[model samples]
Target: MYPPKSFDIGWPDLAYGLAACGRDGDADRWAATVERRFGDGGTKGPESAAGSGANGWEPAAGGGANGCLAALSVRSALDLALAAAALPRGSEVLMSAVTIPDMWRIVVGHGLVPVPVDVDAGTLLPAAAQWAAAATPRTRAVVVAHLFGTRAPLDSLAELAARRGWLLVEDCAQAYDGPDFRGSPGADVSLFSFGPIKTATALGGAVAVVRNPGLLATMRALHQEWPVQGPGDQARRIAKYTALALLTARPVYTGAVTAAGLLGRDHEGGLQERVGAFAGTDLMPAIRHRPGPALLALLDRRLRAADTVRAVARRAAVARRLVVRLPDPSMVYGADAPVHTFWLCAVPTPDPAATIARLRSAGFDAARPTSLGAVPAPPDHQQGARTAAHLVRHAVCLPLRPGMPDRVLDRMAAVLDPEDWGPAPGP
Candidate 1:
């Protein structure tokens, strides 16, 4: 029998995989260089532009010159949530049904009650009316995620939250520095993830943009109280972060689990469950005025480079034709949206299972939606389900990771052409 291939294409690009450790020497060098170049500009202290003072983020907080670090990922979001919910209990935290499990886990971890709202088709933005309808007397906050690097309509959501006197938490994990959404100032809190595969990855960290001072102070305290690695453990942690950034072939910590399943070495749900479980670790809780100065500098520089890469992918995505075509809403409403990971063309094929199976056999690794039933809301609110199912039936997420070879992209696209497959089988 032939041996399995060395590389596995899965969701979350391997280029940004967490499986490999960080590069110590390179990271050290980068750190020193960044310090020399950027100085204390974006560092997590009083000197930071993200407003390191007792007040809001300083202008020098190390994102773009116009940008400041914000807490928005799973790690630091806990701190943001705790601060937002200062009430004794019975607070209602409205969340979207289209988000990953991490968001729900954090909401439940806090003493707040989660009320999930449905999303619109195509773009998983929750209907402002749906949220308005779900609001009750105890509603304390509304948390919305910009899933798949697509920004959910936060303006309406934020306005609704404001009208009802509830805090609006914009989950900008996927929408990193893409563009400023309308009503950002209206939000009580906004968060961003700088994880390994995020739009702007510093390997592991997040920023929360707080419009309220009291909440910011409480969030800082909560971060300080959380568990931290001992001095002895810092070396190991830093080492891991370094390798993960530099290594190209390391088995991605996150993707390896799913990849193993795709390779048939593990039972179904093994990889998915493993991934969900590992999301609980606490990375950075406190907002360092200059969190990972080296990383901040790198992120600042990489954003431009990433935009260049994304531009090319966008052109390709626009040109490609799928075998089965599903209509997509053209033009993202948000001015600052990231280049999509997939252009998302769909087919109307009857047997998606067999189609996926065939693709897997032909050395391509395709995936089904992971957030299908993870939302806390009822079945009806999961409009992302219909969107995802529609996409999955005839669509495949081809490899679009940064630096992915164009030849591979073309080959994957070729497989999706309906002409390549025979007539659809009838029921």
Candidate 2:
């Protein structure tokens, strides 16, 4: 039972973890730097300043060439963006009805109302008309998340936001290294995640780019006041990352998967739960923690070796092969996007659990990305939102990683036959 996908940690991550155990000297130096810059509580620290093109930290194309802010995660970045935007309390923020649960929490936590907009069944993105229909007088902002590495229709959404005098925030958490990767030139702010499953896994971190200098200043101020992750927290992260790396190593992963199967467990799901169960006191939301030097070094190494262009090309090639072999190519989400990095080669079906079971039986790992049944929807958009929600429940994400073996793709395609997974046609 090979899991659908595993963490991208490798030798470098292991080395970093080993070094982190005795990195007291490096940690002390970082603490001194933090104290020197932020001790007074009035000046910004090196970590906060790193996003401002200082200390060799420059914004990437996906993040835009603007002042940037680093955060503990994408949720934190969104929190900072919402605060910096200074929308009136309880202002409406339009977002796709089908999105991560954490995103909804962050929006509501910021004293903002999340207005859910229905998404297109094919592309899994909200249409500009949908956005307009969802907008109310209280709508102050729109968050366009590029789901599954599909480039959202940013140009149209941007125009709509402009006409309504609404701020546009691009959620590029899944669309980095994509075509038009800057994520809507018209966006007031853009956010990118480097979490475990993202294109560039930094164990955990995120970047937010602000187009306006004033907003950047405001976010920087907020960052300076936010608490940093303590040494214990950092140590826990290192241990978790290392454990995942070892568990997912080729030699160990098969046995781990078998053990999970013996216990009647879902390999991927169980692994995610285990990895996320941290023991230390939880940091406050939106706290800006400086990644340790070792972690930063590992991230830099991963980025340099990523070769995103080649990786995207490989993903596109695999997607093309999958489309030709699958029973219904049109059911593949993001197939028609302007550019697709195929972060998740998702296909909408009528019964995802059954399909995944079939694929697993056929010796191919497959799973659903997330559950949308719990997401809230507005009355007016209920019909369309329900459609998207159903699509999410039945959407199967096939394994599509850079340099994946062709045999795995073939097995996945074979199991996708209508006879095995159910009828391909859907309303």
Candidate 3:
């Protein structure tokens, strides 16, 4: 059995991420901003960092010059964008059926209807044909989600949106480190997340980049109406992030995760139950709160230190090795793209549950990626959408992170070889 430590994070990366939580010499300035915005005697200390300049918060210095607005979370950023677009109530916004359910809630919360389209089984991207088939008189926008760090067909989707006079939104929460196409010709707006599990961890934060000046102004105005995160909430977030940084550290994380796996309590659903979010059951507040200065500072530091080219090359090398060993058609995606980033090396299998169990018993962490629930099918692509859903149900994502050990990769490859294991049982 491969050690549980193989699934944990690297020591250097964890230390670097935690270093951002240190004092950045902006505490006094942040406190003054909080007092000026929320008045004196309020949640005043580090706890009120996210609440500083509630109504007056502008995008972090360099971010605004390019029309990118920062928010507390991606869900809030999307909500702000939808409101800024000012689409008619009940207008339809199409999305891939194989996405996180939180996106559905955001669209519905904005009083807009979410139309689901099927994704390409291999790429996990909705094709232009799927989008065209989903279009209708009421369709007002299309959100192109770039899943698992792969780019979507932005040029084609942009042309379709332009011809149909519909808004084009790019969901780059998982693909932030993959490519920098925010202001590209085809996309009207893009949304990103800086959560703990993302490519770079900022604890909790999100950003929205708007290409249209009118939309940016509208979003900024809407941003002021939402209540700022209170000092208590800020404190909780800081504590949570801090705890995560510590928990994911090498020695501690390995022991904790290994024990949890042994106890049968380390599955994705169980983890979600503990986190109380991301499963679409516990909805987050729909307010457009800004990320605290500390979090932003951390994000900025991480961005500066990131080497996208090297990261992608490293991931590609590992992926290629796995492909050579496993030789499964469903083991990889978008290998032919101009650029590829392996956020999660997902493989489609006939029995996802069994495969996950086998991997877990072998001391490797593996599980199915997030999927939408109860999504309504597009009027014209029901069969295609169903096919996509089926594929998603059977796909299992392998554990792959930068700087992981070669032994771990070899173990994974060995486990995937069919000769080592006979026929998989039915779900």
Candidate 4:
């Protein structure tokens, strides 16, 4: 059977991360290096106009003059941003309806309300229309998440936020196309992640591109006050992912899954807990800290060395192939986006369990996502992100990778097509 997901990191990156643990480099210096790399103003892409990537307002490619900050994770960066902004308590922060649970949890933890903004079904974007409908007097900001490696058009959202005097934050954690592809040109703050399952897995780290200089300075000061992560913890994380890399190879992974089934073990559930960055840790203290030097150095090196352009292109190519092969393309979410990297490639089915079983029979190890959920709608606006809830309820995330055999796509299409599968199995 195929593995469910591939870790974007290689052994070389892990080895460097481990070696950094042995060195006693200055965390501040390393942070500077990492942040500088994040702010590297690559030659203007056809899409982005010229902007200086300096201390002053460097429109993160035309949004605002930009600066960069490194943090433990996107969660840490976001928490710092919210704290620095100091939006009034109980203010509503509109968020894309579908996002990792921690996102909304962190918003709630900061004494703000996370209001869900339903995403368009095909593009997986929270359009301005949805935002207008979701907003109220309490709405103070919009945390627009570009889901499934697709970048949302932000100019309109930015205009809306400006007119309404609301903060515009772009969660690009899953949409890192490459160095040239900075966050939305209009986002006040753009967050990126390099955690285990993210595009460029540094094991653990995050970088924020802050368009507002004052906000950047405030966030930096607050971040510095937090304790640094222990070197031992960084080393342990490196070791854990190293082992996981080996275990997730096709041969070992298939055997492990088979063995777990024979022994009635929930291997997938166990793996999920192991891979979570903040699993079982005290949220307040765990996220409220700076990354250690080892992690910072490794993250800098990864940022400098990664060929995200090639990686993302290949992933998108594979996703396009799959979409064309599928009998009903509408079943796939976010395929309509002009630029999608297929980070999760989730396809919705009426009976996801049966669909998964069929895909497994075809040697695919697709599984339901445990990480994404719908943010709650405010009290008076019930129905609560119906489309977001619908997508999550029936999503069967298929395992699609760049180098997978083309025949795999054909098999997945056959399994997904009702004509081929003869109506999904019933209870």
Candidate 5:
């Protein structure tokens, strides 16, 4: 079993807000800022790195995240992906199998196929040349997701997209701080998520940066026509996000800790129920786009805060111990990422069901993968389905957001010690 907190030992030292959702009750405030920032007549264009040429679009007509405020929400981003699919009904979209179910549902609901693809065993990227070969005429775009804090090899995908004249959609949800992927306008589009646990969790926000003015217009129109999310739904989301922030920030809070104490016996049952619920329904329809000023402020501060990166060994150690102690190790590190605050990708185990159980039993709160495909796959990439399936089957995303305490890290480590793996290793 891997030792807890060992991976996070070298995290860059920085103190920043860990509020995945908006801080306090700033959700509304953030939403307003987003609307103003990307409103109908915004002046700001998309942000571009130095080489993007001087044509960088001005910021939206209004004010928002110092520059990071999302113009949409998680759900809206999904819609934007579908819009870009340009797919015939039921056409397939290849995705890395190691993904969150929510993204899968979004693809299917949008009338696209969900093709799962495999990855490079070592780098956690699509196997060498696999993406190029997997393309099918029906494939419209290739969604290369830069998962966790790691940057995907966007250059490779960009090259492929150019040769094939296909769209390259960048899923920048988990890539909090990354190098800019902006090239010429039509080269590709980038989608960023600002959900809780994301680099800049602004309550609920997302953005799809497009170079094609026409495509951007289409996405913007879809967003404008989107049904207004109701109050109850909004309230529920707020509550859930708030609870998540609390649990993530102070999981040992009296209420949750006490509940675990009283209900640890049925922890497995609870996990099963949660998994079942997650499997049965799509949690997307409930979320909507609404950006405000407070969110923008928080995003700016958080991004600046992130300038101070620290080692997450303390958290990664806990995740590793749990991973090793689990019955399965085949998929322990499909993402092959180095140890950070936690084992950040999906993993292969005999039973995610049981492993989740053990983690909860040990007082660790883990979550499923983030998302799979909202963008379509390329025409030649038949392996997209395989990649996505592998991601689902083997990847294991761990929880290692900012601000976790040392004590909690120690407790987690104690539970996953190799000695606790049932047999001592030979010295």
Candidate 6:
């Protein structure tokens, strides 16, 4: 069966990471190199970069000296940004309705309310007007996540935030295409991830561009106080992913699935647990830390060495083929973005459990996205996020990978044809 996801890391990078784990490299030096290389921490393109040329792309500097900060993960970065912002207790953070549950959890953890703005599954973007309607006097910030590898239109959201004096953050965790296509120009901060499942995976890390120098400094100071991750932790991660990476092979995965069934094990559950960044650990403590030296070194290397744009282009090409074959194109989520890399292409099915069974029968191991959810709309704005909630309920992602054979694409499309996977007929 086809695996549901592929780690972006290669063996060479893994080997390099393993070697770096043994070195006593200066964490500060590697972190500084990453921060400097990523630009002055503004979307202002590479000009903010201490040096440029190879992969320089940031949007706008936001009228100040921008700075970049490195963290253990995007989850860690947001925690720092929110803590530094130090918004008043009970303030509301306007957010795109659909996102990983942890993001809203982070907001709540900081004593703030998350007001979810509805999104169009096609664009994976919340309408700006909906954002306006959702924002109350208590709203102090907006966190817009670019979901499913699609870059949402940021101009209007940025304008709204600027008009209301609200902090605007772009969660580009799933939208990192490469050195180019930096976060939106109008955003106060833009976050990028390099986790186990994200593009250009460094196994685990995050980089953020902070438009406000003061906030950056505050986050930096706060980040420094957190304990550093141990080298052994990263070493285990490298080893784990290396083993998981091997299961992408069809024969091994097939045999493993059979073995799992025979042993009465929930194989998918086991996979999710293994892939989790902090599986079985308490949330806050696990994330509140400086990167270990090994992570820093590997993150810097992956940023420089990752040939991301081409990889994204290849995926898009395959996704386009799939979309063309769908019985109803609208069944596919995130098809309306200006640029969709199809990082995790999924379809909204009326019966997702049945759909997964069907895909599995056809040699595809489809699964629901356990990591994503609709940030429930607040009490006053309950109707605003229906679409986001609907999509989350019905979405089941197929296993679409780079370099997949043409036969696989054709067969996958056939499974989605009108006779097979489309919505039910009228009564």
**Model 5 reaches what TM-score against the true structure?**
0.62
The global C-alpha lDDT for each of the candidates, from Candidate 1 onward, is: 0.45, 0.64, 0.60, 0.80, 0.46, 0.81
Residues 249-339 of candidate 2 have per-residue lDDT tens digits of 6558778867778999878787656654221324333244555544443444344443555666776687777777787776677666776
For 200-299, candidate 4 gives per-residue lDDT tens digits of 7788899899988899999999998999998798999999999999989889999998999999998888988898899998887899989988898677
**Sliding window of 10 residues with minimal summed lDDT for model 3:** 37-46
Q: Looking at model 6, which ten-residue stretch has the lowest summed lDDT? A: 52-61
- RMSD to true structure for each model, in Å: 8.8, 6.4, 7.6, 5.7, 9.0, 4.7
Clashes of each: 38, 0, 0, 6, 82, 10
Q: Candidate 6 lDDT, tens digit per residue, 289-344? A: 88987887677666765366788898888878877877787668877788888888
- For model 4 the TM-score comes to 0.91
lDDT-wise, the better of 3 and 5 is 3
Give the per-residue lDDT digits (tens) of candidate 1, residues 137-214: 878888777665455446777777777778777776655533333225677766766564454354444556566767
Q: How close is candidate 6 to the true structure, as a TM-score?
A: 0.91
Q: What's the TM-score of each model vs. the native?
A: 0.62, 0.82, 0.78, 0.91, 0.62, 0.91
Candidate 3 regions exceeding 4 Å error are 1-64, 178-183, 232-235, 249-254, 261-268, 274-287, 306-309, 329-338, 371-374, 378-384, 404-407, 417-427
Q: Order of candidates by lDDT, top first?
A: 6, 4, 2, 3, 5, 1
Q: In terms of TM-score, which candidate is stronger, 1 or 2?
A: 2
Q: Tell me how far the alpha carbon of residue 40 in candidate 4 is from the true structure, in angstroms, after superposition.
A: 0.4
Q: Which candidate leads in lDDT?
A: 6
lDDT of 3 by residue, 1-427 (tens): 3222121223454444344345343422432332222112112222333332332232122111346676777787788888888899989898877677788878888888888877665566766677887787999998777777776557888888988899888888767653344434678888877665666555566667777889988987877676654434444555655565565555666677777768977545654443432433345563456555555544443443336446657765776666666746444644434445666666667677788777866666676665434356545434446645665667677766556577777777777757433221211
Give, for candidate 4, the lowest lDDT window spanning 10 residues: 55-64
Model 1 segments beyond 4 Å from truth?
1-73, 177-183, 231-264, 267-353, 369-373, 378-396, 401-411, 417-427
